[model samples]
Target: MSLYTFAKNLVAVILFPVFRIKIIGKENIPKEGPVIICSNHTSNFDPPVVGITSPRDIYFMAKGELFEKRFLGKLLLKIHAFPVKRGMKDRNALRRGLEILEEGYTLGLFPEGTRSKTGELGRPLAGAGFFALRSKATIVPCAIIGPYQPGKRLKVVYGKPMDMEKLRNSKASAQEAADAIMEEIKFLKENHSP
Candidate 1:
């Protein structure tokens, strides 16, 4: 394993139980190959919460500002994260995501684009769907449910992968596909509310 993987795993082992994280449906993840993990954004902690609970290394797209700090940016890179512009189409980020998939790695995306301040599910952005369509990768819908309080236990639910082939061939637009994915996440969130 890469040093980054080891470091992340160590941190997860150390903190997840302390945070009372409860992960479900880990077996739903494919054992290998490129997979897209599309999840809801409830808090700033959601990324690490999902990432640490996952069985494999998951690369995520952060905003460009996160990477502007040299030290923190270097650390993020080591942890397999790259940056995308917040309000604009970031071609570079798109390319990096495709490259990660092409390299047979898992990629995590919050289709809602940003964290939900009120902890309500937001309309999903089309980036995740577009990536799935372009890369022909399987999309695993995930939901993280809980308040971000230190002592509260969090729940993570993983849904079955969406049928990308059907999505690709159907009349559904990219945004439609993204919405469908978000709907699945919403269902899981409500059902598995912590």
Candidate 2:
């Protein structure tokens, strides 16, 4: 296994039982090749929550501020997380994401940009759609539900790959594509609510 995969798996194994994570639709994840695993933002724990449950290495975009703590930042980098400045368009982060996709690796992106403290689905930013269009990669819509409480199962449902043909052909705005993806995620969230 790759070093990042090993580290992620190691951490996942340790936390799985502790968090009582119960993941569904894991098979929906493409076994290989470049793909974007788009998910909803809930709590600060969402990244690790989804990461630990994934069977493959899924690199995530963490905020640059998290990397400010030299020691913590180094550790995060080792585990396959690169920094992205929240709000402003960070070209460096976008470049790194593209590079990861070009290398045939999976990337995890939260369309909402930041965690939603309200637990409701929020507006999605266009970055995920932009990345998909730029890389010509498949977009896997995912919904994460339930509280990440100890002994309480945390659920994640992976939707089928989104149809990009419409977005590819028409003059549909990036935000429109993102909203459509978010709508699918919302449907999954409602259908799979615990």
Candidate 3:
């Protein structure tokens, strides 16, 4: 198996038992073509949870600090994680994201830009919306619920692919697309039961 697959499977083996992950709406993931998996950030565990549950491989833009450690950086890179300097507009990272989509790969993004301290949805960064508009990729909003308590169920709900055509034609701002995506995620989180 590729390192990405091995790592994803390894993570699933380690976390699934402890977290009892429950996935809903996985079918919403497109079988082929470019896709953008947008979700809220709560814990560091969110990425792995979403990655393992997703049907396709996911490329993520992690914080640049994560790559500061040599070993961890290489390992993360091997497993499809790239570094991005957070809190500012990093053009390289944005370009890389668009490239991934152009190549028809899945790009995973936490629209909030960072983890929420109170486990509440935060305003989405314009990056997510930019990717959707620029690449015109299928955007899927995901909501992850429940804490990382051992033996406690962690639920991940994937919403339907958003229709961006209207927004694209309306000459909507990236922030507007980001807001709409967040609204869908909020809906899933509030309505989907654990």
Among the numbered candidates, top lDDT falls to 3
Candidate 1 collision pairs: none
Model 2 per-residue lDDT at 190: 91
Q: Can you tell me which runs of candidate 1 are displaced by over 4 Å? A: none
TM-score of 2: 0.93
Q: Stretches of candidate 3 above 4 Å error?
A: none
TM-score of 1: 0.93
The local distance difference test score of each candidate is 0.86, 0.85, 0.94
lDDT agreement of model 3 with the native? 0.94
lDDT of 3 at 162: 98
Write model 1 residue lDDT over 1-194, tens digit each, in one string.
Answer: 98677877887886677778888888888989999999989788777877887887899998899899999999889888899998998999999999999999999999999888888888999998788788867789998877666677878889888887877888667798888898889888888874
**Superposition error at 3 for model 3 (Å):** 1.0
Error of 3 at 80 (Å): 0.6
List TM-score per model, in order.
Answer: 0.93, 0.93, 0.97
Instruction: Say which candidate scores most in TM-score.
Output: 3
Q: Poorest 10 consecutive residues of model 1 by lDDT?
A: 145-154
Q: What clash count does candidate 2 reach?
A: 0
RMSD of each: 1.5, 1.6, 0.9
Global local distance difference test of model 1: 0.86
Clashing residue pairs in candidate 3, if any?
A: none
